[model samples]
Target: MERTFVKDWRGVHKAALALILRCIADHGSPPSPAELQVATAAPSAETVQHMLQEMESRGLIFRDPGSGSILAAYPLSAVPTPHRVRLADGRQVQAMCAVDALGVALVFGQDTHISSRCRHCRADIEVSVVGERIGAYSPASAVVWYTPAAVHCAVAAEGQCPYINFFCSREHVKDWKRDLSAPRGQILPLERALDRARAVFNPMKGLGGGPS
Candidate 1:
């Protein structure tokens, strides 16, 4: 893991981040600077914009390259993905990626219900979360694989990649390999997978074994 120091909260406002997240939860996406200004009443729209820019630059969130609106912040995604994290509070949010679904539960400090489809079989896979403990994955035993962030700068790009997958079992992974052009990712057990998710959400922890 390269020491890419993420100075958490330096020159950033927790309230601003919370406001953006609240917008996402309420509106299904981040508000525009104008909307954010109206919602936060943060003196001016420019101030809100500056705070957003600072957040993105600090790796606290990922913004849309074109719109500059919040695209993602860890477990939450402005754009929907197959991975969904349903909070115990009854608020559901889409995750940026497979590992991110797990990170969502960790970040909120609540039980979560993760729902996604297997990359190969397309069979529904669901996992339960109780605090830090993860329940047995549905569709039987499963393994998660991803390219470690330490090796590749973009562990997850703008869209889904074959590198991130959930195999109902190792045999299914082998079955999928036959048709692939190239192979990638390291298969991880449930516990190690959760640990990797923790490292991913905590940039200060640096890279882990895999993304999710």
Candidate 2:
């Protein structure tokens, strides 16, 4: 297994970041800069924007170009991804990726309803997760595959592809791999996937841990 490490969150206020996350969990999105200034006691809206830019440079967050609002940071996203998780308490949120989708279940310790569509066929793939086991699956044969350590090359603008996904069958994944001509990822069981998400997104539990 590859090692996992937390990102450096310097030049960003830890309490401010924590408050932002708390707001997301409660409100489904980060508060606007003006609202944040009141909530976090930030110096000014301009200073908050500067702080956001610093966090973005460090890969700890992504902000909108026009409004400077947060698009995504770790477990949360303003724009939706393939993975959607619904908690038992009726709260719903989108995750950054598949791993983060399951991480939401682990972080909340709730029975979760996870849903995503097969990228190749556009067929709905859904699963219910109780603790670590799949409580139910629609097709009863769906499998998840993920790259353990997907690489990223900012200079060449390569290696930044979607790393995890569900497939109806191994044959579907085989067909999909013909385009990339790269090794496919290993199948991940539900429990292992959830554990991996916790390691990346919620490593510190009650303590404040920045995005991986």
Which digits, one per residue and each the tens of the lDDT, describe model 2 over residues 141-192?
5666677765221111221236676766666666677766655577676556
lDDT tens per residue, model 1, 1-212: 11122334342345455555655655677767776555445566667777678777766678768867677765577776777777777777877666777777666666778898777787888888776678757876777866664322222564443466566777777777777763556777666778877876664221112112
What is the alpha-carbon lDDT of model 1 when measured against the actual structure? 0.64
Q: In model 2, which regions exceed 4 Å deviation?
A: 1-14, 22-28, 132-134, 149-161, 181-184, 204-212
Error of 1 at 67 (Å): 2.2
TM-score of each: 0.76, 0.72
Candidate 2's TM-score: 0.72
